[model samples]
Target: MADIVEVRNKQVIFKDYINGYATGSDMVVTSDATIRLELPKNDDSLILTKNIYLSCDPYMRNRMNRTMEGNYIDSFTPGSPIVGYGVSRVLESSHPKFKKGDLIWGLVGWEEYSLIKDTRTFIKIQVTDVPLSCYTGILGMTGLTAYVGFHEICSPKKGETVFVSSASGAVGQIVGQLAKLFGCYVVGSAGSKAKVDLLKNKFGFDDAFNYKEEQDLNAALKRYFPNGIDMYFDNVGGKMLDEVLRNMRVHGRIAACGMISQYNLDKPQGNYNLLMLIMKRIRMEGFLVFDYYHSYPKFLEMILPLIHEGKITYVEDIVIGLENAPAALIGLFNGTNVGKQVVAITNE
Candidate 1:
């Protein structure tokens, strides 16, 4: 057994339940917390981890609300550290499946070190050739999200016309690439010109537009997909969704991955195009990635090769320290990060 080691642990704590959008002030980052780098005596189920990288996801915004409605996860406690997907190096472990020095990714606290009791959410890292940070986004939850949401939920067909909202984001970028690989004609929308360029030039989307510049989203969709959209991978909901519904082809499929547009609002804007679903015979479905985690091995098998062979590309907007996590997370809502936002607590 390794000697018990105690160290100062820096943590990003959730200050309180919030209303509307979140800001850096809603969280407190401090190094006052400390932890013993060992599992509690005789506890065979607990795992001690040194968090290496933490993921900043837009869905975390809803979890900060005082009252979580229809959310799969619970709201963060007022005085505790925020928890999210992260990659960590195991320092000590009592669980039969893990051991000291093993790397894993799943739900972890926003801290330098986390004592993980729940192993159900954790998955051991088998491949180390890629950047470990990839586990926080591409090789982890967001990658799986793009795969399942597009391939399974969207039920995409080759040569079909597809549109992805927030196409420059972690999930959206991958979704667009997957659609293209599946022999579909893809168009994407992002918030900035650089992101739009990235979609067309980097990810090989057929076309991309800056959504913020479009006065009428309906017109933009019409210009891109004159034949009407066959599949819609929706990340930004609200207005975009309503417009897309009007432009969808008959028998179209919509995968409702997220509603980032409505997260900060007190009352979510309603989509007024419910009638379009009926008129077009659309199949729109909302999915939580947790439900499809059972197929993670299959997802990795498909994604890893594409990544290595250069068929797929992933970009990350990584911040260097835990102290900067609040700003990194807050930036997700304001369109600040250009790609997957990750906070690197330490290099392993």
Candidate 2:
């Protein structure tokens, strides 16, 4: 008989349809007993997996509301396991592309082990030089988002003045660093004093500020970029975005990576300074990371070298154990996470 530890699969369940701000209690973790890993007797199309790490993203908020329509991302079903990108180790594989011991990163259930049938979507991890948890953040979707949003969307130029909101966040951190490497004068806005300090002292942002402390966002932008912002990476939308629009230079570019500010609101807020885009000849565009999936190889080529040479740095805020996954994810909305939020399961 195979020795099997009682797998208490803890899943974050959606309480109900959300209207206003989301609370940690909105999600409940239900523990269930799971059987030991077992290979399919006849099916050669399924792969049993043990999730090692789970990614906590801001976008998951969209899935909470059932009434919201036209959202390209799928909503999490009530009374079922919440799904997101995860780094997992294959325990039993029947797919040709994956083997029994392969480490992969892709969409997986919140529980301990998942029987995934769609192996095509999963990317097999060939590189082990970096930490496995990074697959959930910098080395994965977050990195890809920063790369495509910066290089492809913003189309930054040297000596340009760049401003990034949520600058210490998963995507924002990389975006600011990339802008710096491109020889742009970069400034960042973070939620906390600690995050602002990390942006200036650690992440090498030329200047950074705590958005919470700024009474007038327009004045804050003027203080950072006196000449005018040539590129704006809009991570937190609403007031910050409106201020950036007001201060953008002619032909400026804005890459709308995320709108963290509006995620918790029942009704989306409108920017008062919409006319500024016309006056400044600014180009604002929203992008999804999956849109640039074909260019991922090109992105990896550009970023991997920077990582190896120590030209780029990544910071992750890891919460231990699958049991804490719900709290880790809920913390993102409150700006509790300092960097890329990830749940480290098993610590291996």
TM-score of each: 0.98, 0.96
Instruction: Candidate 1: give the clashing pairs.
Output: none
The segments of candidate 1 whose C-alpha lies over 4 angstroms from its true place after superposition are 1-3
lDDT of 2 by residue, 1-348 (tens): 456454666666777777778777777777764645776578888898999999999998888888577797877888777789999999988888889999999999887888897776688887889889888988899999998898889998899999999999999999999999999999999989999999999999999999899899889999988899999998889888988998999999999989989999977898899888888888999999977778877877888889999999999999987768778887888889999999887766
The top-ranked prediction according to TM-score is: 1
Q: What is the lDDT of residue 203 in candidate 1?
A: 97
- Quickly count the clashes in candidate 1: 0
Which parts of model 2 are misplaced by more than 4 Å?
1-7
Candidate 1 residue-wise lDDT, 1-348, digit = tens = 566668899999999999998999999998998898766887899898989999999999988998876778899998899999999989888999998999999999999998888999999999999999999999999999999999999988889999999999999999999999999999999999999999999999999999999999999999999999999999999999999999999999999999999999999899899899999999999998999999899999999999999999898999988889999999999999998999999754
